[model samples]
Target: MKKYKLLWLCTVLVCLTLVFVGYRAKAQTFNSDLPFLIHTAESLNGKVTEWTLFTRETVHLASNKSWNQKTKSLHKQFPNMAWTYVKNRDSKTYTGISRKNNYVETIKLLSTNVNGKSYSFLIYEVSGKHWNDHKVENLNKMVSSQLDKLYDKKPVIFSCIQGHFSDKIDNVLLYEKNRLLKSLQAKKVEALEENDFYSVSAYSSKLSQELSTKKKEEMNVQIGLRKSGLGANTNFVIGTPIITIEY
Candidate 1:
């Protein structure tokens, strides 16, 4: 009886482990908006050259000592990073950059004092040019983990990707607008800006992040395409909510 009971317990434990793993795998599949961006780029036959994720929060600090403590804490958290500081008349900023073989991560802490009250704005960003689908999962995990630790409440995140196609196509803006709307299941809210070379602003249900304007409409998922002035390549930018980096 004891031998059979031991075997049954082992089997149950194995089954439970498998179930947990399966659940985590499923959760990871639709966790972030990066995969959708990657898919759209692939569909357009573009090679992704750069991508970025950024989030920021503002919090009340007690004093300059608190600011220093926060910076020291970040230094310990990311020991490999070197930090630089800049000060102006009203505020001081600390910028730290960590460069790996493929990706670069930046953290900025801006502090200001107003009428004896101190405030700090914390910003975190990560960018890379070379990554595959599996590596993207790691990037998402890294961003989520750090943001969770840094802020008690969730911060709004912006994701941007840049890529290029070897061959230039005519009417690239209209081509991308239609393709992305189909790929993202999104509708055009309004063209924030459009020209012969670029298109921006749209909305999609597939994305979890969105922004609401006074117009009573939500805007998320922005796309921009511009032709290379000298080459036969076309460059594109895809961002969720909005693109913060310069195109």
Candidate 2:
């Protein structure tokens, strides 16, 4: 009886130890320091010259800073700005506007906390009647620079709604990812199919097809490093390719 009890206890301890180690290894595979979405945003940013910063948000942080405090910090960086706030049943939006060289730049900040992580969205809306590719590139670069300065350590995921249907954009994104993986000296990179989430509805079908067709010529490859062990890497699509980065 004593021997049987000792064997059962030993087996339980070994199982628990294996479970804990597996969890830790899985956690390490994800680039917790920089979310996959941020990497995708950066990749897309490099591909487009006239993309708008539709939204930027963060999740799963250790900070306890209030939304007001965070917004105030951002405001200090951009002096001579006017802000307006609107409250809805679910969320609040604080919008800041500034004009430079006849171009109106608007930054809308939306704040909410879910579970324990603070979520904030910085929406950059640039106004110009004639927004050529050159102008668009400059605007995106300027906004991205400002964002980088504000959230140096935080991982920001961005969405671009303007150039979602362009085949050129898709090609550039794939090229960049391939180039990046090669630069990283990754042993192998594999393309992932669009998830069912993007294939369910008609609207999603259109967007997913445009962004992630299996056709080799038009393929929106979401390359993943095979050695990363991140488990079936998936493409991020929100009417466009959102996050496609490997740790």
Candidate 3:
């Protein structure tokens, strides 16, 4: 009886140890997880520009400290801040944008952490009118490069070892995770004709509505970028892909 009791105690300790370690790992990962949406737009010119938002969780993006700073020099002293679908690759397909295009660097927004404070990221590449070969080669590179500019950490150059991706499965043209992903199309042409502010507000409003729908649940989302499009108008619209979560 004494021996059996001793063994049981050891077993319980082992199980507790495992649970503790697992919890710690998850906590660390969550802190660094930069949740974001990937989308695409065209310059006033016909250039297709790819982009990503760390997150515009009204709480952070609304902060004055976020969108303005050009350099990280003030990040410590000041404290910080911060697309579309063309196709489906397959059962093994994971969508991310390329960073080779110049538009990607300019339009790219900085990180905006929410209440829990998680960063954001976007990957994009531009191909003229066809997406016969939609590659994810720059997904990691572009993200890493921008990480260097954003954070002071040395190993900022990083990749998501454990992240999820999807294609336009339901909205067919806008969302990747079928059944739940919502579509938010911006004002077609009239908004842009007025000026950049109208177009910006229109784009932000649509994105905000789509995000609000997802907030009802507890899932994480990574918006996808479409490599090709039907060319709706002179403006290169930013397309959204909804990623819903159950846990």
Candidate 4:
């Protein structure tokens, strides 16, 4: 009886392990390569209910508490929420709160000078904002707003509506920033590899600042995006769109 019970227990353990592995495989779409941020979001939905990507230290994208408050405000303020999975380490789950509630505001601390002048960046803390902030609302009105006050032409906007982020926009916000720089004519851009200390934007500003110290200088505008763990070695099979704009 004891030997038979042992055999039954072993069989049950093997079956249970197979079930667990099967469940996880079904939960997160197992793609050998991650395509784009858009593709990742679509593949992860209704899979594992919710799973945090491998814990990468959150970089506190927003500098202050107000930014967190804004995220919360947008969460509450928006009527409809859009679901998206972001690629951080593996992938993170994101929900689009309404535009009124989802506006994001962050400050880029400038390292040095730009175009012969000290370059510093700061924006007012939006305590309560919404997803609508991401909307392609009045590009006309914002043409006069600070968002583009300094630019000559709107840097090739890839905007959709404000309430929810389409696969297109998710790839833009979380991915395209770097790829765009390599394409811009007015500036010298460099595509930095992972673990590089500075983003392309930061690098551009710092370069301009260094140039200011030397002699004549130009403002080198650089768009930047960082990569995550969803690369070729992972289970990021397909259906996810990772937006990689040609630079």
Candidate order by lDDT, decreasing, is 1, 2, 3, 4
Of the pair 2 and 3, which is ahead by lDDT?
A: 2
| lDDT, candidate 1, at 43 | 81
Candidate 2 residues 4-58, lDDT tens each?
A: 3343344334323322232111121111111222344345442222323332444
Candidate that beats the other on lDDT, 1 or 2, i.e. the better one = 1
In model 4, which runs have C-alpha deviations exceeding 4 angstroms? 1-122, 125-179, 189-198, 201-215, 230-247
Overall lDDT per candidate, in order of appearance = 0.71, 0.38, 0.26, 0.26
What TM-score would each prediction reach against the true structure? 0.77, 0.38, 0.24, 0.23
Candidate 1 on 1-247: residue-level lDDT in tens? 3543343344334323322232111122225677788787888677888888887777676777888898888888777788999999878998889898778999999887789666788998888878667676777777888877677766667788888776655666577668768888888876543344555567787887676644656777677666655556777778876666655
Which rank order by TM-score, best down to worst? 1, 2, 3, 4
- The 10-residue segment of model 1 with minimum total lDDT is 20-29
- Residue-wise lDDT of candidate 3 within 1-247, one digit each (tens)? 3443343344334323322232111121112221122222211112332222231111123333443333233233223222122222221111233333332222233343457564433222222222212344344444445545444432211111112222323333322222112332333211111111111112223232222221132112222222232332222223221211110
Q: Write the per-residue lDDT of candidate 4 for residues 181-239, one digit (tens) a residue.
A: 32222243223333411223222321111112112332222222322222311111111
**lDDT of candidate 3?**
0.26
Using TM-score as the measure, name the better of candidate 2 and candidate 4.
2
Candidate 3 accuracy as TM-score? 0.24
lDDT at 168, model 1: 54
Model 2, TM vs. native = 0.38
Q: Which lDDT value does model 1 have at 90?
A: 78
